[model samples]
Target: MRCHPLLPAWRAAARCLGALALLGAAVVARGQGVGAGVGGEAEIAAVGAQVQQLARDSAGRAGLRDARIEVEVGQLDPRLKLAPCQRIEPYLPPGLPVWGRTRIGLKCTQGPKPWNVTLPVTVHVYARSLVTQAALAAGTTLAPEHFTEAEVDLAAAPGLPIGQPGLAVGRTLARPLAAGSALRAADLKARQFFAAGETVRVVAGGPGWQVVTEAEAMNPGLEGQTVRVRTESGRLLQGRPVGDRQVEVML
Candidate 1:
């Protein structure tokens, strides 16, 4: 028996409805995908704007009145199995433009991947011109020597006792000393007498007689006189004097 002609029309209508339903589903899926991509881009742009605003605020606080600035955001990693908006670009300070391609690692919720997304931006400022003009008008230049290290010698001469001016070795003497005469070191000598706030003594002269100390007292004793020296054991011994309060005793 032959099938009814109305059955063929019903079958055709069913096939058409199935195709239309699939087409509608595909259109809806494509729209959703496009919306998601656009949302991600909008989020990145919003982040970039926020970062730019912060940079502007900081520059204002830093006394930079005429600085131009910008901010960019992009993915740090692409192979990361995270959300599309998980990565972000870093904030770059205003400076001279860097030429050529450069890569920098960014911190993101996405897994680590180098140079996945990058942004290049240019910032120009009029402050540099003002600075250059000011430097030129001042007629000055900074040099490395301006920041160099310095040294001072504390052990050198002219480092004298407190409240006492240092006397030159050959100057300030009451009697002339011969050029080749040897003097004992100041620490090894002993004081024979004390007068006028100074120690007057005889220093070792070599074999025959003792040399007089060079220290000058305010009240000097007569030359070629005799003085009494009290030994460490409290014995008073007569000593022949030479100059100032200096004296020589028999060894």
Candidate 2:
């Protein structure tokens, strides 16, 4: 009897093939143990779009017009194994608030695993606002030539920008305003109607009887505000201003 010379070579080839099969099985088992996570560009877009739309829908209420909304989303945990989501809902977290920097919520539903997450968002409201063209003193009364209408990002600028030309026109600044500054309601004071020692018509009555008397204003006031006035008989009375120069009192 004699042994074939090729027998050893064939046996070695069989052993190599078995070893390769075992290595592949090990890789498959490890992959199954580690869960697959949802992430990357495509998934991010789907989630971000949902949040962006919610922002746009509420833009008008934020005083934003023709707004451009942009969003960025972070990746989920690599170890998470979320089932395929059929619906994704994004909204503001609880407080019904949206401003410069805010949070957006994401909820996934109609899937094997339902989950929620929060993302950071920045909102920019762009529109035409009245801003000072040059530095002006505290008492400087604003006019068309003093300021210019400029398109501004309201989120970055502190205080509300003057919305209309009529708002800033002929209005006295409450404090010194810098050049190219966004103007707010707090920046200016309304023109005074009743100044100290100024005589004003005071009408007091209701229903059927009316009495009109001339009195001196002890304190200056804006239209529709209360002012203390001194009458001819030395009576100090509080009255509600009904017009630009008139105050009314109920008897």
Best by TM-score: 2
Task: Flag regions of model 1 displaced more than 4 Å.
Answer: 1-39, 74-104, 108-251
Q: Which pairs clash in the backbone of model 2?
A: none
lDDT of each: 0.32, 0.60
Per-candidate TM equals: 0.24, 0.49
Looking at candidate 1, the ten consecutive residues that score lowest on lDDT are 129-138
Over the stretch 1-251, how does candidate 2's per-residue lDDT look in tens digits? 11112222223322322232232222222333245744455545554566456545544444343554444445445666645555566555766234455555556655567876554545454556677889999988888888776666555544556667775788888899889787877788766776777888999898999999989888886754679988999998999776656889887
Supply every candidate's count of residue pairs whose N, Cα or C atoms clash at under 3 angstroms: 0, 0
Best by lDDT: 2
RMSD of each: 36.2, 24.0
